[model samples]
Target: MERKKKTGFARYINLVNLGVFVVVTSVSLPIYWLVISSLKQPVAIGASPPQYIPSPFSFANYQQAFSQYGFSQYFINSMIVTVAATILVLGLGSLAGYGLARLPMRGKTTIMLTLLVISLFPGIAVIPPLYLMMRTIGWLNSYQALIVPYTAFNLPFAIWILRNYFLGLPKEMEETGRIDGASPLRIYWSIILPQALPGLFTAGVFTFTACWTEFLMALTLNNSNSFRTIPVGIALFGTPFNIPYGTIFAASVVAVVPIGILVFVFRKSVVSGLTSGAVKG
Candidate 1:
């Protein structure tokens, strides 16, 4: 009876594993197909029943994306925008979070709720005002146009994450710093900051991903070919006359690579950040 029960439990575990594998594959198959399709020639891309493998694998599509359509410049623009915005978000968000968590305020709860509400506002709703403000300030077609807005829009979530993480930290160290005559900034820099690495990385990764994948603001804030980021460049890849599916697919795969690499690198930090507040320690 014991052996039969163990066998049944093992079979159930196998079934669960199979279900998870199926779900993961179902989601990943499209991405797999996209990557495979990118390797094919233009002629093979749209072949009926779809060619599972490239008939003659070629790097021509990738070359066209980078060289002919200027993905290289778009990539640089995206990097600048993503890196700058992420820095801004992490800096401002950490400071804001520290303040909200540590400082005594009469309406702090209300203030945090307001921030959460502000973050929930539709991005589309703010575009007109943001566009006009950027135009009025003569920041149009500038990296600042995208970077600044991305920072502002992503700040609330960063602040929320960091603040919750901060709240979970023991106050003993902070109190000791206070007695040692360390300035508030010094305490934050030395005491709180070191302990908050996971939170900072979490906020930074979130901000980076947001800025990297952002499209609407990228499209609206800049119109110059030189200023366009990857999304816009990819969207406008083919003329109205011809859509280069292979090149588009190749560009998409290229675009996804950086984000995947980033997440893979910082994945441990992200996991730590998310789980930091779950238990007492």
Candidate 2:
């Protein structure tokens, strides 16, 4: 009986391992292909019997993306919009989250529910109205056009994450600060914000990623080359007659680098923030 039980447990463990292997491979294969494709020379990219491994790895595509295709401008535009939006989201979200989590206010539940609903509204559903508004205000084809919308759209999720994180913190800390005659803002800035680093990092990462990869709004709002983002710029890479797959792949790899680095650096904090407040109000 003991031997049979051991065999069954081993079989289960093997199955779980196989499942993990399959999932990892499925996710990684495409990324591997993209990286390899980016490294291959332009002619070699679509060669017969696609090169699984780039024979003569060359960075000509990357150079062409930056110098020839003006991807540098797109990269800069994306960085500006993403960074500005992320900063605004974090600054505004922390305050709103702290208030919702700690303050004694009427209709708090209703407000939170409303925020969740608003966040769920699809970008496509709201784009027409947003485009009209931007056009009316003469903000079309500008950085603020994208930055403002990104901040507004990402703020709710940041607030929810932060509010939940704040709730999980000890109330006694706030009470102690109050006893010391510390103002709410002072206490929050000094005591609360420091401990909420994990939540902040998580929110920042998510907001940054969203703003970086956002397509529909970016495309609709900023159509001009001067204001085009990575996604928009990548889409317009080559003319209909001749497509530049190598350059597109290189640009994509470049765009993915920042996000990959950010996530990797803050991975632990992100994991902790996401899980810590999950069950705490």
Question: Each model's TM-score, in the order given?
Answer: 0.94, 0.97
lDDT of 1 at 49: 86
Model 2 pairs whose backbones collide: none
Q: Which residue runs does candidate 1 get wrong by more than 4 Å? A: 1-12, 278-281
lDDT string, candidate 2, 49-150, tens digits:
999999999999999999999999999999999999999999999999999999899999999999999889898999999999999999999999999999
The 10 consecutive residues of candidate 1 with the worst lDDT sum are: 272-281
Candidate models: Cα lDDT each: 0.91, 0.95
> Which stretches of model 2 miss by more than 4 angstroms?
none
Task: List the pairs of residues colliding in candidate 1.
Answer: none
Best by lDDT: 2
The numbered model that scores best in TM-score is 2
